[model samples]
Target chain A: MVKVVRNVVCPFCGTLCDDLEILVEDNHIVGTRHACRIGNAKFMHFEGAVRYTEPLMRENKKDDFKKVDYETAIEETARLLTEAALPLIYGWSATECHAHMYGVELAELVGAVIDNTASV
Target chain B: MQDVGYPVCTLGEVKNRADVVIYWGSNPMHAHPRHMSRYSVFARGFFRERGREDRTLIVVDPRETDSAKLADIHLQVEPHKDYELISAMRAVLKGFELQTDKVAGVPADLIYEAVEICKNAQFGQLYFAMGVTMTRGKHRNIDNAISLVIDLNAYTKFGLMPMRGHYNVNGFNQVLTWVTGYPFGVDFSRGYPRYNPGETTANDLLQRGETDMMLNIASDPGAHFPQKAVQHMAKIPLVCIDPHETPTTQLANIIIPPAIAGVEVEGTAYRMDGVPIQLRKVIDPPEGVLPDREILKMLIKKVKEML
Candidate 1:
């Protein structure tokens, strides 16, 4: 079964073509219409089977990455940020403003600088 | 983001009144497939009488692109010679011939023909992208392209805009400018806005080995940046915040999977031409996985408490 959702904007490029018709079935984006090749690829792979659904950790004592609890991972990250003298928090081109503001606030709290994909 | 003033118009205006559409150094067919079908060729606008039949399409590039194949006129100039061709076109429009019979590998006749097309159009729109901005003499190439449009105003109503990349790239530039007083590369390490592209740009700093730790959000520098920059990223303690798996994820010490903006999360984004639009969610993300802002907000609180 297919249900076409209309006027879906493509978030890939700056064109932001909003007349897209997505074919959804069982919460999976089965197909799309009125979009470019890039948009199709992005939509087609929206739900990745290999996504990291849990917090991961590569602690100094451990030789390999270990799946850890979310709170533990956050605490580890906070510990690292607190220790680093001049951290570089970067990459914000694909996110929203509220998130970018949070990133900035995090960077500022640590007296660290922030950049974006524009820099790289 | 510069203070340079130029003629500006919305995409709606292009659809409504533009009789001649010029794609310079861009292949919208591959880059922006629906641009022609929606805005220039097939849009049922107020004055466009018969869709594509009422308009003329022109393409200018060093090599023929997929989009150029559909052009009524294609000016295939030499690579790294766009500045010369643009200057020559400007000179021709002002009723002057090039000192050489051929300039930028294009014959005098072809130059004149392109000049004629630009001059005769009732409402012409020039859309250019990285071709003019990324090559040698980048700024000069843009200056000449803008100058050509400015010159064309004498004969016809013309507007030109950069084919900006990314749905919200302009949004970052706009928002950063409004809040921080500078566009892309703004530094606040000193607790104030410090603006300098070369000095503060990501790759430059990475190449120079300036940063100790790197937190990458929503962008994959490992995939797009040079191997040297990526190598630098690998050496540092890297953190990634994105929805999908990319090469950057491989080097990341911490990979935070945030809810996909415009997909699992709703927010506002700025289009290439500075038009703001709201993004609607199509589905829910994984349970407990929050939006980018929420995740960052979590880190902000933790980082602040630690600080």
Candidate 2:
């Protein structure tokens, strides 16, 4: 049976229409009502699309990314930043404020340049 | 521009009171599909009881976009000449006559008529987007438009807003301003937050090859950034944190997938009018997947320990 969730906020564009009705069946979104075309596509297709489910790592740019555990990925990322003289933390537009808080803290600790899409 | 702030209002106020709506260089029909029906043009409100019939819709663009099709008046201005058009509008509003027959491919008489409509409005709104911001004059176009709105206010109520693109783009600016004392392109290289747009901004840093590493979250710079910037990013040890695979992910040295915000994770996102709306979580993310905050927290802890 499909379950209907009303007043669901769309995460696609800045409009952030919050009156959408989402239809979910078997834990997957099946459809959306009162949503724009872009929002509808985002809701109906996100689950079935090719998504990165696990953390991945690659030693070199030419190498294929190998699946790694969260611990290893985080550790390696930290190591890369610690070893670098300067690093950049970019792209905070699509996420929420809590994540931005942590991102700011990480940039401070790493002494990195942090920016968002607004710069572009 | 921040120092000389312009008159503005919430989308709610616009929906209720706006009798004259001007879309300058923005095509809401394509970029923001529901913007017209929900707030600006068609929405029926307390004062705007008859919806579309009660409001005047005006669109200014170089081309006849879908949004322009619905406008009561479409000022098909010349490309990259928004600055001149705005200047002409301001001049006409100030009761000055133009010697030229046309300005920015728009007739001077039409501009006079448009200014008259704005001057007579009970409540008027002007919205601009990437077309104004990314054009040749860039910020100056916005500045001129704001000044025009200010001039209009001498006769009537007027407000202006930028048609922000990303869902939380405005939210990011709001949060960063409250925390760091500035918005975007912040550098912490000296143990203090410093903001210098052209120098510390991501594209400049990447283009100059000044930064040795990058931690990209949520946005896809690979697809959106210039070739030089993307090439520099491809050369660096880049870490990307996002829910889906993008061009940025393809070039990333490390990819960490997080739960999609506003879907699998609930958080506060500011609307285009600086109104904070709580995003709802209607479903669970894939097993073991976390939100951006969680991943960033773990990364922060790890980096702290390593340093």
Candidate 3:
């Protein structure tokens, strides 16, 4: 059965249109109503082949990434951040507010320079 | 506008009462497809009963964009001349005659007519985007535009708003301001938050290779940043957390995929007009995939332990 969810806010763009009706069937998005072409594309094409579903890691810039567990990924990330002299935390425009709060906390903990898309 | 102060209002006010709508250097027809129909031009409101018929649309752009085509009057200004155009509008609003026949490639007569339309409006709105902010003058153009709106207030009601990009960009600013007392380019290096735009901003720091590691959340700087910044980002250790595979993700040393916000995860996002709205989750994310907040929280905890 397709469940119709009304008043769904679009994640794409700053308009944040909150009157969309999303049709979901078996955990898959089927259709969207009252969304623009961009919003509709965002909702419909979320689970495409291009989407990354698992954590990945690479030792060098030129090396291909290998699939890793969340714990290992987080540990490596923490090690890198803790070891670095100056770290930059950027890109908070696409996510939610709670995520931004955590980002700020992490930046504070690591004494990193925090910024958003507003600068550029 | 730190000096002159900006006169602005909610999109609700624009929808209800704006009679003269100006799109200066913004192509909403393409960038914001439903903005006109939903809020500004076609939306029927309490006072705007006739909707588009009741409003006069004016588009000021160097190129004839689709939005310009729909405007009642399209002022084709010269590129990187928005500051001059705004200055001319301000001067004309103050009852001063232009020394030149044309200002910023727009005729002086058209400027006078546009000023007349704006001066006579019950409620006027000016919406601008990258066309002005990313141009040669940058924030100076915005500052001048704000001054023009302030000048228009002497004759009538006028409000201005930036056509902000990104769904939660304003939310980030609001959150950062309330939490750390700074909007963006905040440095926590001294164990406290400090803001200095030119010195601490992301682009400036990255271009100067001041940062050794980068933690990128939901935005793609590789696709949008300057070549120098991207080059530095490529040379450093990048940890990217995003749902989609973007250019930034390709440059990451650790790619942690998160559930799509406002899709698989319910959260709060601020609209362009600084209105906070709740985003609903319509579907479940892939197995074991977490939201950005969850992943960020875990990282924070792990980093705290390491420190």
DockQ of every predicted complex:
0.57, 0.85, 0.87
lDDT of 3 at B28: 88
lDDT of 3: 0.91
The per-model lDDT (C-alpha) reads 0.78, 0.90, 0.91
Give the true-structure RMSD of model 3: 1.3
Indicate the docking level reached by candidate 3.
Answer: high
Q: Chain B alone: TM-score in each candidate?
A: 0.93, 0.97, 0.97
Better of 1 and 2 by TM-score: 2
Q: lDDT by residue for model 2 over A5-26, one digit each (tens)?
A: 9999998888889899999998
Give every collision pair in model 3: none
lDDT of 2 by residue, B33-99 (tens): 9999999999998999999999999999999999999998899999999999999998888889999
lDDT of 1 by residue, B66-151 (tens): 88888888888888899888989999999997788789988888889888988999899999888777777765677778888989
The sequence of per-residue lDDT tens digits that candidate 3 reaches over residues A11-94 is 888878879999989998899999999889988875453998999999998999999999999999999999989899999999
Pick the lDDT winner.
3
Per-candidate TM-score against the hidden true structure: 0.90, 0.97, 0.97
Relative to the unseen true structure, what is the C-alpha lDDT of residue B196 in candidate 1, on a scale of 0 to 100? 77
Candidate 3 C-alpha lDDT tens digits along B61-98: 99999999999999999999999999999998898999
Clashes of each: 1, 0, 0
